[model samples]
Target chain A: MPGLEDLYREIILDHYRNPRNRGELESPPALRAEGFNPLCGDEVVIYLAMGGDVITDLKIAGQGCSISQSSASMMSAAVKGKTLAQARSTIRAFRAMMSLHGQALDGHGDGASGGGGTGAVGPEEDERTGAEVAAAEGVSLGDLEALQGVVKFPVRIKCATLSWHTLAQALDEAEKGAGPD
Target chain B: MALNDFGPPLDVARIKKDFPILDRVVHGKRLVYLDSASSAQKPLPVLDAMQRYYETTHANVHRGVYQIAQEATELYEGARAKVAAFIGAAAPAEVVFTKNATEAVNLVAYTWGRANLGTTDAMVTSEIEHHANFVPWLQLHQEKGTELRFLPLGEDGTLDLDQLDQLLDGAKLLAVTAASNVLGTLPPVRLLADAAHAAGALVLVDGAQYVPHLPTDVREMGADFVAFTGHKMLGPTGIGALWGRRELLESMPPFLTGGEMIRDVRLDGFTTNDVPWKFEAGTPPIAEAVGLGAAVDYLNGLGMSAVRAHEQALTAYAMRALKERYGDDISIHGPPPGSERAGIVSFAYKDVHAHDLSQVLDQAGVCVRAGHHCAKPLMRRLGVTATARASFSVYNDEADVDVLVDAIGQADALFG
Candidate 1:
């Protein structure tokens, strides 16, 4: 009986209606990356100004459904001032939380700690990998934790993660010392 | 009953029962299928016919003097006759069986276009055509150096006939769809046919979306060629037909010149068979054609006029219900109320990606199509990446529409 109303929370709706930091940053020292969801036509362009290990500035410009755009808005805010290591750690944690494998991050002695009561696991096992990736990386991602609900809707998972994937792409480009764009 | 009312009133519930695949659960709920635009569900009669053909008449047609070969040839030609009658063609010889509508369009482009079109020749189509209709013509343009033109659509999703006059000038062929698979807009086919004829252009109607819901008569439409698929019309996959005027078929070169399509073959040259056989090369989809024939008989028994009426009523009800429930939060594409249109309704819910909407609907066991519907140019015209579409058929009713409306309302409440 869980409905779409449960998926689109008021905060998500607000971000979609009144999108924050919704513009492209000019090219310079920033690494920019673009991600596209072919199924939904959701696209994201992430700009990251990395000052050594720390991300000094981050912004996103994209057009997509509420889930994708709001997820991007939330993503830009979360990674703005984090160090490169911290950003990767936070992304791992966030991905883990969304994949409902946060128990792996909880470290309850058992190496195979499953995130119980998360209701994140679905019939599709591929989703569990997202959680496994997050568990592998060490960070604590909260609030964005709400996106775990996306696992129940497989198609929406792409929308919720388009921005994150773009951010990951940006970081990859930064590591390579190449412009993300 | 009169000859006009040759068919019986469709027992929709019984027909629905015949489709065993329809009686299944998806996402832990009863499946409510609404994606008939992509492909239609098979009925028991069509399925049984195909099974019977494979069981009894399983042989390569037109070669062996064996009993099975004769039976197979008879059944295959009979299927061709049924297809010809289904579309109101004068004879079975005018119907050429192809793999599907895409291949049918390709056949025209490769054979007809290559033989007739020159650098000075032109091909005209609309923006709303499915890629099957669009790409083949584009390939023809590339190969023959022919000019390719498109009839622009108005804001309301209808073709601008005023623009059509200009595009049709000096055009050799007008390849257009009878109904848009995405927008659900039924173009003015008779009008376009007349205009193309006046401009000295032969018309090829892509009836892939149209044939499934409405009754089609090639003579009445005055089209030179009409292409459609069996799968979309409650028939088996891998079978489709291209109905062309007898003269056109005779004049056009063979599409695939091999095997049954040939009369005599020498080391240096070969002679092709007559009319439909000349175009249908290799081993045709014999069993699939048999199923298609049964499908035609089934639809004829149900009466196409009634089917058309039923869908129109369902579409109107769906449109009214969607507007009432969601107001402007949902954007419905295609013709307005009372205009000639199909049961396909393509739209995007405010702030929700079509895939997201489809997921929400799938969870509710309400199936629909989410993507460009193979009309990328039409999607660009509509200024959206994709839209979720729910198309109706004879099997669909008010309850089906309610499922779609309720699902959309749920998506709106969840994502808005």
Candidate 2:
């Protein structure tokens, strides 16, 4: 019963119109990874400039739907200038929020619903807000919480997660190619 | 039905009553399905035929000496004959039933292609073919080391046949689509067939998109092999057919060798069955074949010429509507309104991504396909990552096009 208003929030639309860190970083200094959602032909390229366990800079390039582009923009803005551990935790928390893995993230057995979600949370629905999920993972979502509405539409979940997956790929590759520190 | 430039127009309102799914409501709006190119909605007769076959004559075909088994075999074989007649095949034995059109293309590639082609041989196809036709030949090139050549696409979304003679030269086989699934470009199959013939090569036409909307005659088109599927033509998903010349089919070895495909099993080897059954390996999609037979009957009743004409008129109306409403804001890819294109209308509205456009259209119960359409090569040729395609069928009319245009406008308003 979720409407388009819930999926395409003003914040998401604004982020899509003006993407953050929208360019390419030189490959010699920065690691690049690409992700593709073959279903919708959504491609996300993540460029990460790492300075010894800290992500000094991040840039995104590609084309896709509003959900994907906005998610990529929000992700770039959230993770930039953060430590490697902080970025990884943010990635995990954001994935958990988007996938509605509330039960696993919360760890507590009780079904206490988290507050702060602006949309209608029916009694039958999974009521854990993105903030609560992030809090459980010991990280905050900030503006990326706008993408939590994508959970209502399962198909767009891939679109939202595509950039994050590519970022993770960039991190993994960067670490692998790094020398003894 | 009255005569028009396209042909005798179809009675869409009357035909719409035949498909039960046409009455469905989505998002509190009446369903306006324009993804018929991806898969057409099944009519009542096709559904009834499938259910009736399962309820009354449920048995494995080409097996058992009992009366019911014989009846089952008759129905299954009868379905093959109907499919052959639908496409104007020379004989029923020339049509080999496979899982779907993809499987049919692979069968030809593995059997006829692998057997005849080699490292020196060159196989010519087009840039506009679906992955089903493209990948099989690519695989052939990879394994057999055969040279692969593509007929380039022109700027106007048609194949650049000016290079046809050069590409066809020294080629052993030419595999091409009868219609481009993404661009709605109807390639000149007869012309291509003749050119390939003069080049001393065989022709395989991917008729998956063509057969459903247009009147298909394998012989008239001069095709040695024509591949089409049931699902896209209002039949069930599991059944499809490849109609080849009987001599060509008989000459090729069995692609999948097992029980039904063999005449007799020996200790060392087995003799294969005759022509079509020689390629049909195991338990076939019997009920689906029966449904396909019923679909053929339904189309025949409506007439294929009428179906083609209906889609042509609808495509023309949709083109005019979109241009008139959007003007410089919308870009439609493919041949112009009258250039013998199929009913597929792939468009990019304003700056809206195809996925976003489709999502908004989904709210209004307008189902369209938004993606590379399994034609990434063609997408690249068209200089786009994806496009929102609205295809028409016998059941769709002008009202459907109107709804589609309005929904597209809604997308533009929201995105803008």
Predicted candidate 2 versus true structure: per-residue lDDT over B1-416, tens digit per residue: 44754455677888989999989999999999999999999999999999999989979999978888888899999999999999999899999999899999999999999899998899899999999999999998999899999999998889998989999999989999998889899999999999999999999999999998898999999999999999999999999999999999999999998889999998988899998999999999999999999999999888888788778878999999999999989999989876479999999998899988999999999999998999988887777888999998989999999999988888755688
> Which prediction has the highest DockQ against the true structure?
2
Candidate 2 similarity to native, TM-score: 0.94
List clash counts for every candidate, in order. Answer: 1, 0
lDDT: worst 10-residue window of model 1 chain B: B1-10
Second chain TM-score, each model? 0.96, 0.98
- Candidate 2 structure lDDT: 0.87
* Model 2 DockQ class: acceptable
For residues A65-168, could you state the per-residue lDDT of candidate 2 as single tens digits?
A: 99999999998898899877778778757755765443322222211122223222233445455566568767779889888778888777777877776777
Candidate 2 chain A lowest-lDDT run of ten = A104-113
Error of 2 at A47 (Å): 1.2
lDDT of each structure?
A: 0.80, 0.87
